[model samples]
Target: MIQLNTKRQFVYFIAVVLVIILGLASRKYSNFLPTFLAENAGDTLWAMMVYFGFRLLFVGKRILTAVSLSFLFSFGIEFSQLYQADWINQLRATILGALILGKGFLLVDLIRYTVGIVLAAFLDKLSLKYNN
Candidate 1:
């Protein structure tokens, strides 16, 4: 595999923080958004945040590594919703838990995740290109 350049951890950290803010704003201000955006923006931003989080954590890794890990994690959380065991459900009931684990599974969320990860990777590449 081709070696990709390392990313600036601080930049990725800022990206993650900004994405989290946007995700919260998307939910808080959903009424002002168009129907589709209101419904999908939060999830999209959530996935983007996940991608940035991975990038931040794996600073020396290729962008594909971050993208793949983000997808695996995001999809894993979504799929975990299908298992309704009491222990996990209880955990999901809490605010932080719900934010991370989610309450239920929706197929559409997978597509939203894909879009988010792809967009984040694209943006990261552009930033890298300009930085170099």
Candidate 2:
């Protein structure tokens, strides 16, 4: 197994948790952010999904694993909004907030996640040229 250091594992852990929280908050704060961002929060969160997915995949796994987790994390957040909490949803009201707090979940977000994955994968390939 690939053993990540405490800090690395923590970073990954926090990333997942934070996104989940943001996803939940975004739904509650439906009135918090811009219409454009609010409408496409799925895409923005998908980018985070993309980033982490790529990061994990870079470490070596079947592409499906990263893709599955990416969709799971993103879609999971979209699903959580049905509960409607206060503090969590409050995050959707700000600029970055809307990015975190989604407006609402939709099947379309899955498409965005797919696009984000492709985009991230492309960026990952591009990064290889310079990151070394």
Candidate 3:
């Protein structure tokens, strides 16, 4: 049976919150950042947030599992953009939906999500190795 590590889950939850704050800040004050970085950072951070969220929920799972699930979820949301119903688009127009669902599909966003998940997984593994 898998054990629940409350400490680790709490840490992951905190990290997710931090990432969300950073992501929102990046979007709000993007003018401060270079155009290239600002354009991609929010999406990348969103992927990281997803990764940490999965980590928080599945505390004892392997990092690969969490990362894979994050990627699948992120990619699913991105591809879902292909469907543009009036109701769905209206939802996407809101702050929460805009943040989660995004405005449109971009192939580059997939690459950003992949990079974010891989980097998060690598860092997660490193943290686990060193903490132990």
Candidate 4:
């Protein structure tokens, strides 16, 4: 189980990196993508990456653990945008902070996050079944 988990963690890490690349590309190359996808893919991939990150950290835990934690963490970050103090705003101004914390809130983002997390969890379950 430990060896299996180590392998799983490696896979999840790769997944996270891929998601990050895709997310950045979705922004950088938006002109090449479809309108809807260009508008939504970055946030969706971000949420998916978050789910994969949780899975990577909690390799032995159930899928629901990662799903639930991803939802909480993603939603928390979205809602945190409602608070705009100088310190946090300064952090949000930086490239890394803007990527992680976002600059504004959008109800659509909640929906995007929901879709991303569900899709990630579904894929994770499929991978588990295939491996088993």
Candidate 5:
């Protein structure tokens, strides 16, 4: 694996921060995001895009591994919501909230995970070709 330089590290840091911010923003204020959030299918599909896009931008892991991690993380978070953390749950009910804090668990979320991971993998390859 190539060791990231200072610039790359900075980019990575920013990328990670953006990912977190977007994730949080999506959770806390879904209405502020895109038109897709108002629609269930669009929201799920966009979530997959964000998940995969983050993985693509991240440089610390192998493509497949990174994508898999993203998929697992998404799945875990959605599944964990079944426990119903009041504050988190309430937040998820919002437009952005729903994006991050999904409304409980749905089998379709697994499909979203798969789509996200695959997109991440594809984007990772694209990044390698163009950015590496």
Candidate 6:
């Protein structure tokens, strides 16, 4: 098991919060960024946030396990967009809903999510290696 002590878990939680803030900022101020980056940053950060969130919760899991779970959850959320109902749409219209469920589905999002989770896994491994 990949166990992190209380202090490390708290740190992971803080990182998740910071990433969420940055992801939101990226969306809000996207017009200021270059077009390519502006378009993709939010999606990528969304996956990264999921990875960190999983890391925070599954502190005893391996990095690859966390990454895999994050990818699956992100993909599931993306796929959930295909279902459209008034009630669900209304929920999707809300801020939290939009943030979690997303507005639509894109094949490229799967790739972006994979990239984000892979990067997160790499960073996780690096952190473990350096800290040990």
Who wins the lDDT comparison? 4
Clashes of 2: 6
lDDT of each: 0.92, 0.60, 0.90, 0.95, 0.61, 0.87
Worst 10 contiguous positions by lDDT, candidate 4: 1-10
- Candidate with the greatest TM-score versus the true structure: 4
Cα lDDT for residue 89, model 3? 99
**Candidate 3 lDDT (Cα, 0 to 1):** 0.90
46-90: candidate 5 lDDT, tens digit per residue: 445555445445646666666666766777877887888677777
Q: Estimate each model's TM-score.
A: 0.93, 0.48, 0.94, 0.95, 0.56, 0.92
Candidate 4's C-alpha runs over 4 A off are 1-5
- Give candidate 1's error at residue 8 in angstroms: 0.9
Better of 2 and 6 by TM-score: 6
RMSD of each: 4.7, 7.8, 3.1, 2.7, 5.9, 3.2
Give me the displacement of residue 59 in model 1, in angstroms.
0.8
Model 3 residue 132 CA deviation (Å) reads 0.8
lDDT of 4 by residue, 6-108 (tens): 8889999889999999999999999999999999999999999999999988999999999999999999999999999999999999999999999999999
Q: State the lDDT at 118 in candidate 1.
A: 96
Candidate 2 structure quality by residue, lDDT tens digits, 1-132: 546654534455556566556655666675897876577664755556545644653445544566567667666766765656687677766667666556666777667666766655565455545655
lDDT score at residue 41, model 4, on the 0-100 scale? 97
Residue 65, candidate 5: Cα error in Å is 3.0
In model 5, what lDDT does residue 16 have?
49
Q: Is candidate 1 or candidate 6 better by TM-score?
A: 1
Q: What tens-digit string does per-residue lDDT give for candidate 3 at 55-118? A: 9888889898898899899999999999999999999999999988998999999999998888
Where is model 2 more than 4 Å wrong at Cα? 1-45, 48-58, 118-132
